[model samples]
Target: IVLAPVSLAAEDPLPSWRDGPGKAAIVEFVARVTRQDSAGYVEPHERIATFDNDGTLWSEQPLYFQAYYALDRIRDMAADHPEWKEREPYRSALAGDVKGLAAQGKGPVVEMLVAAHANVTTEAFTRSVAHWLATARHPRTGRLFTEMVYQPMLELLEYLRANDFKVFIVSGGGIDFIRVFSHERYGVPPEQVVGTTGGARFELRDGIPVVVKTGDISLIDDKAGKPVGIWRHIGRRPIFAAGNSDGDLQMLQYTTVARNEDDTTPRLGLIVHHTDGEREFEYDRESAVGRLDRALDMAPEQGWLVVDMKRDWRRVFPVAGS
Candidate 1:
């Protein structure tokens, strides 16, 4: 029997993306920057691309996944601290009162986060997150948190990498939390992820060297902090960036908007507009989680491509086996 050879030419770089203005714009921008002869061509090392994690690359609705993980950790550790039963945040958290916990303020939230995330070895925290991602399901979707990653965005990540673009995940979520699954789920290694971080220090635990997480926060990589994180961690402006909400507005601006007429490097800013409630979600301006107000308003002026999920994605998620 003769084996038929596959035609590489027939393969689509972004199969999940529907053929439309949004997809076309992305393809054109990539081609322009990658082609050496093109006026918009960018050096390979400068072909950096960054993405926001939550609503941009996955479903953030109901609440952020990491928040759920933190809440679950707090609940699991409740038995050790009986005083938590009478505390403001812990009592609300223990009772699964999200609104009550929020009403308490950022102080309570930070206290809960530090309690749940700190005072432990980084390795142990990673293991715990891995375990939760494996067994815990989204309250609404019934899918594992990792499984909630968008199919279209996954394809976009791979596509960018294939075109010699170094992709990084710049999220507002916890750096350690996102690092646990970034590689396995998005093909982006841990070092390529930039997110909010808590402090840590090298220590000797049980006569073995380990990094212990401290309650102190080192960075909050969101909104204005997004650009600073990219500068400090990545040390290069991403030529391409994708995000879905106001939290990402500065990131989009930093990537595509020119500093001056003299600095005209080709750039592409993509916004994943959640307009498909039937398939995933439909939200903007008014929604609390991943709100898309300022960024949506600025897209036209910034020349950012806004991908309407309902119209531009043929597939919202990977099927049972795909």
Candidate 2:
């Protein structure tokens, strides 16, 4: 039988990715799962894919974007609370000393987050995050935080969606905060976002029912909690999962390695290794935020595909106008 010549433009789904093991793995996996006659073929509904937000989908270096938002919120509210100027974390945060604030450890950091984000109505908080995202720019890149997303991963998300996979953001960031931009930035809807959450209470004010943020921590959504969050939110096991740090280890394991006796579907787990200091930030294993040690150790034995950003990606962030 005569064969039609293939169009490289039509066949190549990930243009920003270099021709390497990482890119090839992704392409081969997608092809296998989408092929009708392949044993790895997955039904459209069963092709659920979960992605970690912070380091996997976007840049999380310097600090998580949500933390930056919290710092901004503190500054926005500083005039009302003069006492914060003398407080531990708030004082450091107000002075723009991220290092100092981090040095205070998790306790003080949590206090700052609660003070900035909690005690507002959910609607008001949503509006606050929207305003922050509209105006805030990353300190180093000077780009809007939403624009700092990995271009290759953006292509991956689009590619997955094109293959009829239902993509979801399973992040350790605040659910409400991420929901504001996930739809516009990643094409993942608010309903598909599962993240760390604070307690919320439903109340009636002015005869209108509304949800208000509470100071209580509801879910952490990192480390082992990732799987728990996935189970609680998506209800079905994802056939594919991608993440960047050790916090995402359990989610990767849950998606790719774990299996029930009755289930025999193919799975893919991907880890994005930040190795491009010039293009992005080179960090792993030692960084305070998005530490990747354990996950890196497990990737080889677990058969997870690790994408070395400096080597595997032709572009880190999207080029201007593209």
Residue-by-residue lDDT tens digits, candidate 1, 1-322: 9989999857898999999898899989999999989999988888999999999888887667776776788888888889989987788878888667645543345446765667899999899989988899988778887888899899999988999999999988888888999999899999999988889999998899999999888878889989999998999899999999898999999998888989888889999999999988788888767789999999998899999999999999888434
Error of 2 at 194 (Å): 0.5
Q: What is the RMSD of candidate 2?
A: 3.2
Q: Looking at model 2, which ten-residue stretch has the lowest summed lDDT?
A: 102-111
Best TM-score among the predictions, by candidate number = 1
Error at 266, model 2, angstroms: 0.9
Quote model 2's TM-score. Answer: 0.91
Instruction: Give lDDT: candidate 1, residue 46.
Output: 88
Identify the runs in model 2 with alpha carbons over 4 angstroms from their true place. Answer: 1-9, 79-88, 103-111, 260-262
lDDT of 2 at 145: 89
lDDT of each: 0.86, 0.87
